[model samples]
Target chain A: MTTPAGTWNWLTDPAHWAGEDGIAHRLLEHVVLTAVCLAVACLIALPVALVLGHLGRGGALAVNISNVGRAVPTFAVLVLLLLTPVGRWGEGPTVVALVLFALPPLLTNAYVGVREVDRDTVRAARGTGMSGRQVLLQVELPLALPMILTGVRTAAVQLVATATIAALAGGGGLGRIITAGFNLASTPQVVAGAVLVAALALLVEGVFAAAERLGPPWTRGGAR
Target chain B: MPPDDCLARNEWICGAYLSTRRRILLDATLQHVRITVLAVLIGLLLAVPLALLARRLRPAAGPVLAGTTILYTIPSLAMFSLLLPLYGLSESLVVAGLALYSLTLLVRNILTGLRGVPEETRQAALGLGYGPLRLLLTVELPLALPAAMAGLRVATVSAVSLVTLGAVVGHGGLGNLIYAGMNTYFKAQVLTASVLCVVIAVAADLILLAVQRLITPWTRTERA
Candidate 1:
């Protein structure tokens, strides 16, 4: 933990790269935190958004609430949770915090995607004797797939980045390395951690971008 | 003897604790206000110029804007950790990190606003013998201001929340209070900080709404 001027020496050290406590392990932890948070967020947000989008009456309020959620600081929420009875368990608090952090984009995108579907398509489906549920599943869902995927993409990137804050609350991730590096004034560790996080973000963005491209052509046309 | 001992132990300590909690809330509110203002001002100064450069050079703008998008997605705690050794517990680190976070939103909005300006207006400005600067200031910027301000409003609210991350670096904003409360298991302090952060966010949003109204009188007039 000593503050060495040439801390990059760790880069060539086999021991630092080989153990269970290495870069691979940290990345696994990050991925787990991100995945779990996103899964839970989607579970909560998607259904609510779908229901609201179908109703159309409460969509504005739902979207506004989601917008407010976006404005709230993730770390503040994490810290607040950590100070409570829930904080005694440690890891669960981090998961809850990340879920809350990821919710806005998921909800907003789902709602907007459904809301933005062509009125004619919806009208046509209803005209052809499709029930509301059938229209949602058969027609609107396909049309809104691109936007829904885009929201998931946003949530994925956001959750990955924010999972790092778990380090502040003693939850393990790449953020732990970054925070330790800062505490020890070790530039190489800091650089390595930042680079890993940045690369991960790019990777997620690329994956999602490709998925968005592969979505329905009509939605792509609308996007363009 | 038992009653006297219990009363002596609890009452005085509770009174002192309540007063300290009240003081912490007041300090956090003030600190949060300052951090939001500083971050938004600095972010605007940096983003506007970068956006202008992006528009003028369409080829390079894609990669450059992509880089900022990456920056925006980096976790706040991770970014702060990366900056710690060089900046060393300074306000500059927080301000710079928050500004970097705002780049994606601000640049996107600026580009959108500039692109949205009617083609005819630009042609008319050129026909009037106005140079690039004059045309941009007189015709383009005024037209773009509303959209740009929408981006600014988003950035400002984000910056307000992000400044809390500065708490980990030892800067005493609302985040610091929240983190401290969590670390020490102080529920009152945690609640106070959380409430104050939300209040500041809402208040700042209202102020931005007012500023938007002042700057974009046409929007209000149109509404009327």
Candidate 2:
């Protein structure tokens, strides 16, 4: 199972990352899958959250259901889906699984954020002749943005990290490098892949932190 | 016999499907439950001391805790793959990876719980001539247990879910059922495993809730 001692040399070799069928292609696929999942999850969860918050109903059930969703392993979901007729053993199933993984946090945070807005603020909006939709759009959404963003930030990191598991299902990513290293008993290659994944996670976290800081003060330091 | 029954054959396909899927699911469920419990137990043993150390030494705490957080964010499959070079496809590798993943959440919650103790309570303890060790044991630790337990609850739920990924290494678990189903395209096995995982998560959460109530009666009162 041993490869050459410098097996990791391929990591930085321009040719290994540049052409078709290179690491770059896999990396691009990984990024696209992750992005699509996050986008889809947000689109679906946000409206549900808004409606739940607006009606002041189903909040507990929604949050509890999401907690259950989050508690189910992403890999398990992916594997289960792959067993279905609808799930091909590729990017499609992996992306769908990741979207399900991301949904709970986004929906929970959005719902809680909107619900926590001061009651007086809502009253004032209504008193000013604002329609229900207008009040939600003008007031609650702004107030909830930061909390919602925090959830997004958390989900983004989780999604990127979990996306690597797609490699097991033949959906390639940086994880392919790690798995290949394992098959070959290559420590340096293993180290290289793990380091790259860690670096990506930190970079995303930092970016999200900055984004959060750019928001209003009230939202920035709100209770977790 | 009815015409439909004759056409369909006298054998009960649904009964056969249910029994086979149920057997696989039950076996996998036991394995998943074992792995999750073992990993969480190990994680708690390691994390409690780390949490205490961090609380006592404020300056070095941030970097150490951050390192754990980064480890947590590392993709589980990638981490397992990385370790396979060193440990191979064994239960040790799976448990170790899961334990490391739980460290961040457990440590952060413990620290947060400790820090969240009211300043006046500590001051009162000091005035009563309690030393640092005694004050921590008698006052801070007791007050912080509820919050730390909340963190533990979250960690346990997470660990249970992630252990399913161990199926990739050929370990037996509910995930194994799902993965096997995927490999053979058995929809019944896939659905059975997934539904069982969800049920396990919900049941575990409810148990944790009861434990929290028992340990933190004051919290229960506050909620009520």
Candidate 3:
């Protein structure tokens, strides 16, 4: 098959855009799943990391422990979730899998961001009558904002790419397009689907990068 | 396969399955390691020259890094699908995609490592009559080794995780077993493959950590 022309035709077809399986619909599903997964990951990982970093205790240990999760394939996680009773919940399994997949970077960056803050600055904040909670929320969190944002960005891009696996488990996302292409042996449809996912991933990266650049200058340099 | 017999028996423990599929498990494990190592090495080879070029020419760094970052954001499934039209379910496509995915991490780390060398050290090397090539090979790259190692460790682990996606493209690995198990609703097979993937990733990382320590003993301090 002449995939270039075929892919173009598939992409341009109005028929591909009018139903639950349309590109726009799939794109929305992909984005919504990514957003939900990211939100849940942040809710779970951020507070724990921030507190550990603020307390100046167990930050390294926590980051290292969570980093272990990196080796476990998200596909495996999704499949295992499917095999368990959680499989009955459909979207719940995919969301849980993606959240587990997204945690390490968020936890690591937030912890590092807080731990890497200038000790003198923290001390000065305390000396100026900032309470412990105040020192954490005002001084340390502000200084750690860029890294925290960086973690979010990393997780977001990753979720966009990985959330495709949700389709494999009978959920909906851009991956459904590619898998559908595979089933029909339509190379062009597969290519078009891949292009869509790649484009979305790049867009997410670009947006996060712009956000990083717009961050407070003090936190920017220390983000990595 | 004995999976049918095991299912009939209704006692599908991890140990029971392991004893039955010893040969299949070993082969998949070996293939997984082989692909991961090849991909990481390819990524390192490609990254070094680009990283060096970026380090030498400041203007080129942004574009080079942005390009790789965009590439890195592509979903594993999408990337494999993108290559399918050309490679048609070959391992080469998966390996190429994984290598490409690795460039952003490797190039960034190597550039950071090279840039991290003290300016005075570079000046001193120049004053000592070291040629540009000599300065890089002798002074800068050696100093950059730690960061490069860190990059390699991350790339290797991530590649291990991503290589599982190759199973979707029909390249045999632990992932194929996971996929097969998922299709058949076999808990033991899924658990075994998933655990193996994690074990391989952690083992690869630890081995690289040891190698980094061996190469950079100066970075380690004596215990009291």
The candidate that achieves the highest TM-score relative to the unseen native structure: 3
Q: Clashing pairs in model 2? A: none
Question: In candidate 3, which residue pairs get closer than 3 Å at backbone N, Cα or C atoms, i.e. clash?
Answer: none
Clashing pairs in 1: none
lDDT of 3 by residue, B1-224 (tens): 45456545634365667887899999999989888988888999999999999998989999999888778888989988888877898888888888888877899999989989999999999999999999988999999999999999989998998888888777848988988888889888888898999999999999999999898888886432
Q: Give the number of the best model, judged by lDDT.
A: 3
Tens digits of per-residue lDDT, candidate 2, A69-113, equal 767778767876675554644567888888988988888888998
Question: Candidate 1 chain B — worst ten consecutive residues by lDDT sum?
Answer: B5-14
State candidate 3's DockQ: 0.80
Q: How many backbone clashes does candidate 2 have?
A: 0
Stretches of candidate 1 off by over 4 Å are A1-8, A18-20, A214-224, B1-18, B21-27
> How well does each candidate superpose onto the true structure, as a TM-score?
0.90, 0.87, 0.93
Candidate 3 chain B weakest ten by summed lDDT: B3-12
Cα deviation of B126, candidate 2, in Å: 3.2
- Interface RMSD of each candidate, angstroms, one decimal: 2.1, 2.5, 0.9
Candidate 2 CAPRI assessment class: medium
Sorted on DockQ, best first, the list reads 3, 1, 2
- In angstroms, how far off is A69's CA in candidate 2? 0.8
